[model samples]
Target: MSHPHPELTTPPPLPENGLRVVALGGLGEIGRNMTVLETKGRLLIVDCGVLFPEDHHPGVDLILPDFSYVQDRLDDVEAIVLTHGHEDHIGAVPYLLRLKGDIPLIGSTLTLALVEAKLKEHRIRPFTLAVREGQRERVGAFDLEFVAVNHSIPDALAVFVRTEAGTLLHTGDFKMDQLPLDGRITDLRAFARLGEEGVDLFLTDSTNADMPGFTTPELEIAPAIDKVFRHAQRRIIVACFSSHVHRVQQVLDAAAKAGRKVAFVGRSMIRNMGIAADLGYLHVPDGILVDIKRLGDLRDDELVLISTGSQGEPMAALSRMANGDHRINVGPGDTVLLASSLIPGNENAVYRVINGLMRLGAAVVHKGNAKVHVSGHASAGELLYCYNIVRPRNVMPVHGEWRHMFANAQLAIQTGVPERNVVLAEDGVVVDLVDGHASITGVVDCGYIYVDGTNIGGTDEALLKDRRILRDEGFITCIVVLDAATGKIASGPEITARGFVESEEIFQQVIPKVERAIEEAVANGVRDDQQLQQVIRRAVGSWVGGKIRRRPMIIPVVLQA
Candidate 1:
């Protein structure tokens, strides 16, 4: 059913007796997965995560769900249930914990370990309860059952939450990889079992809902990776997301088979793999792995290097290596295997890193040349199979942008789910289920809260607009020493620029024009600080656009002397 617009819809007084589902993020976005499930004054948050900043969110370290709703009702929240360890699923744990310290975090073992490590980074030691597949845990007014789900990381789980209102199944970021590297496939049998139990609502990941085919099994990539290890006569480096334990497993297996020692580079790659190996999720045969400092001890053909930054992040290990700034460098005989999916929007950066590596005489093998990377989210076929198996009366597609959500809704409709039962949700839409009936009731004030270093929130549109302007056209600041009583210029209306195209000579030529504009604003009796600033801003803006064909941010300062 249609939901009220968030701007118009105030939180419909939490129903007297119904389960209200609201996504603070991850419905209309690709990452930062957070969903709030509420009933009888008790609230449960599923997968508090973060989204990486793109070209648009310049200078933002991470994008998190505005947790004001939960923060406002901290007493109502029972626990935080995490499905996996991926950043998008657990990145905002510290932020959430900071708001309210006592909320218990419940997830699978690997998931808890990663989250614990993150919390430790923030010096936060919150209550963490680790649950396993098939085990049930009761938190507040809900019971949660973790179902084994195969994904990029180990110990990923799909949570089947039971409330007094109904049983809602949330399939966290998952793929039904039949031959997963870890031999732990998604528990479709469990889904079928849950379906038989009568699930009221099924919220599935829609990241790849538009893709037509099933995701290729994770096992398929190891053969190609092994072949690379077998054929490479020089040092071989594989770049991928550090959290891909399965890929790291394959790399370890390949290194062992090829009689080469593996060195983990990059802080994230080392820390995450160490945690995985310690947790028994990653199996590194004795003598097959070596310290990073010892990478130079082995000859080219005797070493296998695994690093992060498959997305071409600037400071990531692979990017640094490409620019010769990394401790480990590759040359003529080396091979750099980019064993990761090129996330959309990362094509440009990834290709730039590839070009740089090629310029360094290193041959790069990636998804383009080989099936080294497969998607971690369910494709259309997998979604259909899940829909048919789960057989929930209501379908709410989560974890995708708007297009993906609509496509997933269409798929749900095609799979015999009533069009009326399929809810197309954005970030703040609340899907309410009562006595096995579902409808989008109202909305919440939820949006993105940017994380910049130690700073949180207040990263508004105006600041972002200023950043964009500064990045694209640079900035021009005019300093005016003014008469205190009269508000008239005392000395100079000087201009300074950082990134604009105006040279010293051009600026000198335009100085008179700028002064005339200011003089005219003054002669016209523009005395109010705001009015004066706007007058100068518009005048300079017009001159810049007309003369230089540029649109720079104009900062006009008026001082009283």
Candidate 2:
């Protein structure tokens, strides 16, 4: 059923000479942060991104935005703007560039470097333009200004956009961290200036809106990490987001202070930190960085391992180490520090890995046990501060789940923005702003484009259902050789089952029953291949569902001989 938008009568088309904001994703979910800004016959994209798969989305590698809305409108797209380097904000660039390889891309220095590296992975070379905070550039019908913001990564930015229709400010994922490691704080002064200039619509990150108080500064973790490093008698393994350069800096500082040589573990952690360090976003002390292969040469107390898989990804280095599959095996007396919060939906996997590490006699410290990690999003108090400073006429919450968006909107209301002015937009809902008034004018097809292995959107709902049935209850296949003209069984009926029966004896006992059902369907005057197959499938499904109390996928194959 279509969600009824009482105010929106028709599909939210691009407004005529008015500004409209369309969330491609990242409204009802935590990741895949994309939005479309349209006005003056020109379109600008903000944050084309992807979502990591949950446990239920088995076999799905990545999920992308349905870029179809912009497919026909590509000519109108002036440039694709990136706010930061996080995967949820930049991961889909390669996918988008696959459609239009020459589209102009804009982002801060570190952000663009990360994007370029990612694009190179897909053999894509796109026209690129770099922008920095306090600088302004004109892109087609929109004037873009980059304002500095503090996040987990360096060189984060918020785009201040001026178009023919109105002035819009998009705050990418940010937090009011006064003591950021890089000394590049979120530009409150710039925000004040934007407020004075008058913002028509304000789009802010809603990831931490429900959490009270401001996010803890990046510097706050140094002491805690220092404590961990000081206490660890053997190797200290730290897991964090690869793109979190500030956190990496802290880990490096702690390791250095503790006289431990640091070796980056995980491919992405090595690559990204190398990029950041070369770009001056990260500072590595002389002789402190060691190659991973040489980690065994150093004494346990002299080594520190920093890796990825802070979210407990199965193949990540930390997980491999916990399972004793990594080259540098960790065991008794080792301390594994998870320097990241548990992302929603990853709790089970993360906890399971943590338990595995503990079972291996390694001490584990995470957010629950230590203040080693801080959220990179603005919390309730920080959002209130942003709302008060920008004082935008219309507020649109972005970059979080539904509850987080709603919570952020309520904060906007508390900051004196009218309840009517706050637009709670989900993925695909279009909010149009005119004369400083914002309303839901339309919506578009904003569905997921899943990436499975080498294919995009390869797993449809039916395929997923079949996979679920195969996983949960196993599957049964029935093959019958039939006489083409007489519609009579010519040879035999063979039944096979997988994941259903444990032993050959049990399977043999079930195969005869399934073969009998196929014969019964054939004798019931089922002639057409399609008809007989359906009948056999249903008969086998019902019989097994009753006998085994399971509903496996019943596949029937009618081969006329």
Candidate 3:
């Protein structure tokens, strides 16, 4: 299999009739999915999305795919074709639109609705085209065909792109859920037909390739959720991804069966579900749905609150409720069902929320203890079936971490795809299709662009390192006053610390070192305030590192008094 190499030079240039495929993100990770296709000097983008921050991200709100690769060529982009409505598939639409609004967005009905609603919040008006399964649209030099696919959400699609160079099929996140809740199964007949028509390159979702079997059908979750509703003695709280309309629908069905009224919590949950209901994707019984404000009027047993934060995002509703920070106090007699799989890197945060809820006398049920959730991506068995059916000339894995992609690549090879035809690449790796063959050509600048509050792409690694130090260690400041005429110490050398467990008296030991260091620097004719501050900083930093073994952020201030 071909792998990205550090030595690979910049791709020479797309051949006159060749198609260039480059992933800006989502090859080695589960989110921040974007891929750029170039043919005839025109660009076609598939899925602009965001990656949620983890512990290491500190103050970051979201991570975007660096758009620098396309900043100069935004006008060349014909349209961004969305495969689904999931956050990881469309969350970054608003940000990308901010760069150059008026770029047309193409997706299914619900997908377009969700993105338009989100874009409305950002005050961006986007031009959009809504297409359904089996529909075809010619945009620029690319002929796009949308095929129905079943996933956790409704109206998911796999795109078939035809260019002069070759035919490529990009399967956005999907599963072969034979009995999807919405009665839409992944269109394998279309895959077989496309295989007969010769798919030159196949880009597949690798998120579940490591799993050994087909993904469990979404229909199976209803029984488990019904059991939870039947056994709960008091109020029920179900936490899931806001965009998971099917799961929310399951919760509604369970609540209706149990004779309970449901209230949607969290702004995202309410907005997304509202859109789904209006679009006919989420069906709610007339009397079973109640406003969150009326939650107080109903008895505990007659209520169900569906909310966000199954991933344990700090600001999400379920997390706030778990930490006793939300108005909806979750305590005794409440059963909180985490109706979603724990995303990688979010285990600790999810566990912390679970522990807090349990400490407050609430019973917690998750995928570990209950069958409340199933993966949205197809597993190894399904991938093998897809490989056998599609039988594409070349295969590339997308939308997963390294291991998942590796596993998917192996599956493709096991199904008779030449080992040489499987391309295993990470984000930023460039692949080109020329003469009916796909190969890695080069790499590009694909870095994480951080979003903090209203700022976009403003925070870099250095800022994150400082934030980590402040959060994990502590902060210390040293103040020294100097005599302008003599270049000598004029007044006190004071040290103060915050976020440290050490007492103020403990810092007294380092104060002497700080004074001596400043005096020595001054005596040596280092009169520059910056130079003097550096000396003091080094002295105090060494003392703290040697004594306390902590590397907190150290600030040194020198003033001529």
lDDT against the true structure, per candidate, is 0.86, 0.86, 0.93
Q: Best by lDDT, which number?
A: 3
Kindly list the per-residue Cα lDDT of model 3 for residues 1-561, writing each as its tens digit.
999988987787899979999999898888999999999999999999999999999999999998998999999999999999988889999999988999999999999999999999999988999999999999989999999999889999999999988999999999999988889999999999999999999999999999998899898888899999989989999999999999998898888888899999999999999999998999998889898888889899999999999999999999999889998999898999999997788999999999999999999999999999999999999999999999999999999999999999999999999998999988888999899889999888889999999899889999999999999999998888888999878877888899988798999998888888877887787899999888987998899999999999998888997
In Å, residue 369's CA in model 3 sits off its true spot by 0.4
After superposition on all C-alphas, the RMSD of every candidate to the true structure, in Å, is 1.9, 2.3, 1.0
Whole-model alpha-carbon lDDT for candidate 3:
0.93
Q: Which regions of candidate 1 are displaced past 4 Å?
A: 1-8, 482-490, 528-530
Steric overlap count per candidate: 0, 2, 0
User: Candidate 3, clashing residue pairs?
Assistant: none
TM-score of each: 0.95, 0.95, 0.99
- Runs in model 2 lying further than 4 Å from the true structure: 1-15, 501-524
What is the Å distance of residue 265 in model 2 from its true position?
A: 1.2
What is the TM-score of candidate 1?
0.95
Q: Please state the error at residue 396 of candidate 3 in Å.
A: 0.7
Instruction: Please write out the lDDT profile of model 1 over residues 1-561, one tens digit for every residue.
Output: 443464657657766768999899998887888999999889999999988877777788889988987888888899999999998889998999988788999998888988898889888988989898999988889999999998988899999989888999999999999888778889999999999999999999898999998988887887889878877879999998888998889888888888899889988788899899999999989978889888767788999899999998888899999899978777998899999887666788899999999999998999999888888999999999999988899989899888788888989999899888888878878889987878887777787799877779979768888899899988888777778676667866778878965584565555566567667877888767787778778877887788889888889887777
Q: After superposition, how far is residue 138 of candidate 2 from its true place, in Å?
A: 1.0
